[model samples]
Target: MKRIISQCSKELSQFKRDRLTLALAFLLPLITLFIFGFAIRLEAKNIPLVIQDYDRSPISQRYVAKLFATNQFIFVPWSVNDSVEIALDRAIAKAGIIIPPEFSRRIAAGNIADVQVLVDGTDSNNARVIKNSIKATTNDFMQSEGLIPETNLLTTRSRLWFNPARQESLYIVPGVYAVVLWIFPSLLSAIAMVREKERQTILQVYASSMTSTELILGKGLAYLIVSLGIALVVMGIGAIVFRLSFAGDPTPLLVAIPIYLWASVMFGTMLGTRTTNQNAAVQGVALVGFLTALLLSGFIYPLSNIPFPLSLLPNVIPARYFIEITRDAYVRGTGWIGVWFAELMIFAIGMFFFNVARRVLSKMQLTE
Candidate 1:
């Protein structure tokens, strides 16, 4: 215990004096948190739309007004002679609406009025949003104008449950916490280990009275403490900047935060043991930690969308489980019963990381 504390104190003392490392530990993470929080948006908005109105009638004008009123579409000026095809081909507009000359006349004649909507299919997801928005606007126009039959057989009284306002930040920022926390702590710890090798101080540690387990635990503890500080500052800023509030019990997050950070530190330590230089250590953590947390963890995209075989990787990923815990606390609010398994997974992965790092160190001692 005394040796472990001594090692931890040495790490913290060294860490405190290094300005660049301090900035790396604190500054870079805040920057990353803000960048990911404000920048990444899944829901499409402000679609550029071109409109060709041939009817010049009151009803046709009303329909056009309805489309512009919503936050969905912004108008792109189109000449009387120019076709919507030209705008689409130029990539100027993502969608185009053509109201035929007989638009109002067809309604009066009891015929179905077709409003042709041309959407750019370059991005399949954006194209789908444009199509759905146009369809929904048309349906709303018919209902408001008494064009559709008032009678309905079955309808969904649908309500957006957790996020009624559909604010993208609410869904995005919490996940940003997971990614930011995972990347920085691991990188910091990994670099700390590799730095010893670069400075040749690791030779003294190899010949020291400290066992592999003691040395690993002491270093891991120091970084874990630093990570907690990072977590608080980053998450507090996220709460203020994004206007995030807990929807359910906060207990799950409290329990999971330390476990997740320890796992991240341990994982970095493992990479540090495997690599001889700081550059190699950083690349290893970025490739393994950043890539998995960002892509495979369902932070931006759904895990289901990830193809099979690769999908199996998330089961062992600490960030994958931590994100589940965070999103649950901030968005879903399901509490311990809902996310207990995820927290357990984080703890299990952390142990696995610590074991790998210890065994590697023990092997190194024997080899030396």
Candidate 2:
């Protein structure tokens, strides 16, 4: 037990001595929390809508005025009576409201008064919010005007699945688990390996009785154990301190720990295979970490919200899969059945990378 403590202590000392790495490990998650918390807001608020009131009637103007009067929407004056196409082409509006000449007459005669709303489908999230807001406002108009009774109105009670309240923190905090784990193990192993190699201490290890596999296991396990500890600490802080709920069974999350650590360790080993210095290794890990966690992990933005083939990007990114799994467990109370696929994928990819890294490391002379 003392020897194990001594080994871990030495590893921790080595970790603390890398000032850049230690700072990144401690600071990045907090920085990311602030950025994602404030900057990446998913809730669509005060979406701009353009008006093309062609009817020139008091009733039509009243409807248009009511739509803008709501704090939920901002009205940009667009008197494009002749050409709404031109307004849409100029990108001067997200949505355009068109009231026809017969609009007032239809409303007075107890007929269905339909106003055309053209939305810029380019920004789908904005479009969705605008559409729902319009529908809600119009429904209110119908009720107040006695077009329908309060109880007899054709009403749809919309409920958001999974995240019912649509708490952004619930979506984001679980994702941090993946990003945090992805960073530490790679950063630790890469820096540790590069430091020894740069200082020429690695050659002494080769002179010893340790095989390549034995050396990698010793180094990778040491980093993995430390990284896993940091991950759990972050999870606890996010849950207990931040009040972010881990709604699922604790067992699945515990099961995923090995998967996360192994993936990070293997990725770090791969980085170490290519890098000759600690700086290069750290930079490589950062680059990969940013791309995988920040851009593709379905953390900062929803995968469904992106356009074209770019939306498919998260599928290939391992961090994204793990993030999805963690979020499901954290926010939705999903069990092992929900997360097993992600665990398997992480294991498979981690094993593949480790084998490749091991083979490459075997060929290289540590003395070189």
RMSD vs true structure, all candidates = 0.9, 4.3
On TM-score, the leading prediction is: 1
lDDT of 2: 0.75
The 10-residue segment with the lowest total lDDT in model 1 = 148-157
* Best candidate (score: lDDT): 1
Candidate 2 lDDT tens digits, 286-313? 8876676778777777787778887877
Q: What is candidate 1's CA lDDT for residue 195? A: 93
Deviation of model 1 at 156, angstroms: 1.8
lDDT of 1 at 349: 88
Alpha carbon lDDT of each predicted model: 0.91, 0.75
Instruction: Score candidate 1 by TM-score against the native.
Output: 0.98
Worst 10 residues of 2 by lDDT: 1-10
Name the runs in model 1 displaced over 4 angstroms: none
Give the clashing residue pairs of candidate 1, or none.
none
